[model samples]
Target: MASVHWAIQPVLALFVASSVLLTGAVERSPPSFVVDLDKPAYERWNSVIDANPDLGRDAPEIFKILTGNINMSNDTWGILFLMAEKIHKRLPAPFKEELQGMADRAKMPISLITLINLAYDLTAHCTSVVSTDANGTIWHGRNLDYNATTYLEKYTVHVDFKRGGKVAYSGVTFAGFAGMLTAIKPHAFTFSSNERDVGSFLENLLEMMDPNSKFLMVLIREVLEEAKNFREAISKFSLARMPAAIYVILGGLSNNEGVVLTRNRTHVIHEFAINMQSDRWYVLQTNHDPWLGDPWYDNRREAGETAMNRTGRNNITVDSLYDVLSVPKTRNKYTVYSTVMSASHPEAIRTWIRNSTELIPPPPVRASASNVVGRFGTFAAVLIVLSRNL
Candidate 1:
């Protein structure tokens, strides 16, 4: 049996590599593509799935492996399974049907699809800066850091919702996932999330089961669709009981106002004003909660504060935002993409995606069969998307 498995593994590796190469995704830099969410949700997802057929199978498996690496137990998986089932029943029909379409097209279980979208407890570290220049142009910059091992090809360019009467907005996200981790509604506001805490497993499960429970992304979507200005946006956010712990930052061009809101499963813990006073023209958030006491937190917090201060409001620009976001001390090696949003003109969004070659770690000097197996795993994660101008 061991001999059979070893022989088949090499063949499977060759097949996957060939598949990726044939798609023409391997030869060029990875590209981003935009989706018009105004179209039926299912139709939009199906189109992307059709374009990258292998991703349908790859995504769920990636999540499964990730869950295991994180020491999540079978009992925890069971809880997530139940939560995914309940969350499906609670989602709006359009989004629910979208997951079903993706599952059918990808030939994967609907529960797995739901689990990938709903599970927000990741060891991702991100830094979001909401700032307004002297000219009143509000800018939101974010660096989304995560394990690049399996997430390289899952990246989606942007999701646009113009005709749905749903806050004409757009931003980049993962393929097939319904949640919006980053978005900017043109002429309305721009917002992003940085994971702060996973919260208790029991609380998260309960939040998922409650019919009235609303995930953070769902609540943010509502704010985008309905809120007309900064005040209205915060009002809506203030009322929501998010399902996980996250530090959310929102910016509006109308008032040049930016807010940093922190929430757990039950209530809003802290909300701070950013880019409010003339002297304080920016805000920063990383993985750790600000109020917590720790030396590492102090160092990172001071570094971010110093970076913002050195740039000065008079000198800040979109390019400068990227430079600060890319600072080695601030971002982890897992950083996959960085984005800059101009809230005043939301149509102007810029992103820098990590190259596929960077996905694989350096090979050790003395190689073994285990190293080959590890390379195979990395190869599977390197599925490609055809380059498209965004």
Candidate 2:
């Protein structure tokens, strides 16, 4: 009996291997065509950010707040921590240690400090405006309206900053001009949809500052470059003739544990589309990770989870920008350097698209015999009248 069992086990193993090989052969057919363009645009943009220290100079302030700078409010601390956590690894060790020191002085763990720092950065840098309605609900400049209970859902991009002689927190409303424009218009601008206009506005405002400071120009150029790459990638990858739009959300994560958790941060591209379909918007989402080979994604997830357990909510979601832009099932088959999405948040986008009126009428069919005969009689009468007049 033992001998028979061993013999059968080997046979079963062989059967399983054969089955796998057969499945692989069936699915291994080459694609009819391939898009093999090397995406150096995104790479260049990332390199610019990596090499520029001034671009992220304000990051440490947020980091200091995250490391338990009780002087700062929770909202301020939260936003900064999130930004720090996202971009921590991309920073040099000296910069990282400086931030860590700030966190240590505030008596917060590095992870918590970083998470809050990230949240702050997202709120401050990405957010365009924040307004409060009669209901006390906060709206981000991007047009996302959220009840006070769900602050995070209120904006596509969140940024907390000092304003109006006080530390003010604001978000880009996901329901306003930014969101609406992004939903309907083709994403062709460089930097951001609002970058050109925003840059202009900033220039006007910066006129009041000391012109000798090259900071403003440097910052504007950096922003413009980032936005340009984003627009170029979207234009290149978006499905042709489709009423779809795409957005590129760039952020970073740490990888202290030393494992690459995400590939090009493109994992979320398909998930974004699936979510849009689920929401009824047929948009595409694209994500690009300059640190694709880096171990930041895994480190960030693990660290975020750990910090989230300690803090009330893990600000990070399971469906990251990367997850929404890239399809996981076909990761090995196709590598997407950029992901496209119909909408940033599919559920809401579907509602908007479906609710909107149709632009064109359906095609008209050819007239049947009886209808054609009636039309012909009318045409004959008109022709006879015209002929008599001639």
TM-score of 2: 0.20
- Number of backbone clashes in candidate 2: 69
**Every model's TM-score:** 0.76, 0.20
Which 10 residues in a row give candidate 1 its minimum summed lDDT? 381-390
* Residue-level lDDT tens digits of model 2 in 41-105: 21212222232233233334433332222244354444433433544444433335544554444
Q: Which candidate should be chosen as best, given lDDT against the real structure?
A: 1
Query: Whole-model lDDT, candidate 2?
Result: 0.25
Candidate 1 lDDT score relative to the true structure? 0.62
Model 1, span 1-390: residue lDDT tens: 001122323433333344344434232223444455667666656666676677665775556543433433354455555556656767775678778877787787777778777653333457788887878778888877665333543554466665645537777677666667778888878888887756543346445555566766567667777888777877887777666677878888843488788876666788767635456677777767667623543354565566667667766666566556544444344556677897688766877663322433423233344545654343223211101100
* Residue range with the least summed lDDT across 10 consecutive positions in model 2: 349-358
